[model samples]
Target: MDTDTIDGQPRVVATDAALAFIDEIRKDYPDILFHQSGGCCDGSSPMCYPADDYIVGDRDVKLGEIGGVPVYISASQFEVWRHTQLIIDVVPGRGGMFSLDNGRERRFLTRSRMFDGGEACAIPLVKRG
Candidate 1:
């Protein structure tokens, strides 16, 4: 369900269940985005919001798009996560308090895996594009 990648390795991706959840969310909210929380009340979950509602800061890093929505992480968080791909998945739980997925009986989870040498090298330079 991932929408973009770099040389066959995805910078961010979503599971089929996550994609389905996104589709469900799109029914009521069309323009949305995902921001990976760097630990807080949500515990590092991917928080979805109405694009116009959240202010994406200048220092935020857009890893890629998943489910037709842009996925971002703070620059500081990206420093630690840059070497890995973000795998967005849906699980049974409450979502972040302010996230769009809240009250939906499911939440967006951020899972990751470290990239191989080549992928790690290819990722950092193009985070903004």
Candidate 2:
């Protein structure tokens, strides 16, 4: 898939490995989706899901096909991910795999170092008082 950019943020593109992984995971869970939100750093990170929950403040994007599996982006953080691609690869000591920026080598992962599944995974990351 080609890369995309909107406003000043990067878009999410699926990598070869990511596509393959998505395919394997989709066999049982076809309703796959992606989501993002503000992180400790400059912006938010991409996440994978099996379904949608209509969460407010979240943006969702359709990533088309990566390894013959369908992908979706969050409706809340669509702006921040305007031009970034989600690269799939194994991270050092990170287990299975993780997502990274296509243009840069930056990787995004949950505090638990595991896939969060969906919106429920994003709640804890939200900055609290």
Candidate 3:
């Protein structure tokens, strides 16, 4: 999937800095995925993991992809974030304890913006089980 925009409007996006960081991470773990934390120990940060290390379950909703890696959120969290565009970026800090980003010093952060009427209507509907 495209990094940010789908068709035209974006459901999830990443800054250039974040994309660069993702590329760096990819050098080590070619196959990776992201799951937006639901305010557990990570405080809602975007967590990265090797695809083999994490299981994408039915409760996870695929919002979009970034740097060719898929990003997902829990169905319950999706309900709360459905109206906004998720912006994935990097910040100087520690990552989630169990996330791949943990030892990197820099962590993935999730910022967002509410979709306007047109964007909201244009965004694709995600089917969750």
TM-score of each: 0.89, 0.41, 0.87
Across 1-129, the per-residue lDDT of candidate 1 in tens digits comes to 222465588789899999999999999999999999987688899999999999999888788888899998888888777778889999999999999999999999998888886766566443443
Local accuracy by lDDT, each model: 0.85, 0.41, 0.84
Model 3, residue 126: what's the lDDT? 55
Against the true structure, what is every candidate's RMSD?
3.7, 12.5, 2.8
Report the C-alpha lDDT of model 3 over 16-67, residue by residue, as the tens digit: 9999999999999999999999975788899999999999987788888888
Flag regions of model 2 displaced more than 4 Å: 1-10, 39-44, 52-129
Alpha carbon lDDT at 36, candidate 2: 48
Q: What is the lDDT of residue 34 in candidate 1?
A: 95
Higher-scoring candidate on TM-score, 1 or 2: 1
Question: What lDDT tens digits, residue by residue, belong to model 2 across residues 1-129?
Answer: 222332322234455555555665567666655444344542444444555533423334554444543445553443343333445432323221232222223343322122224422332221222
TM-score rank order: 1, 3, 2
User: What would you estimate as the lDDT of candidate 3?
Assistant: 0.84
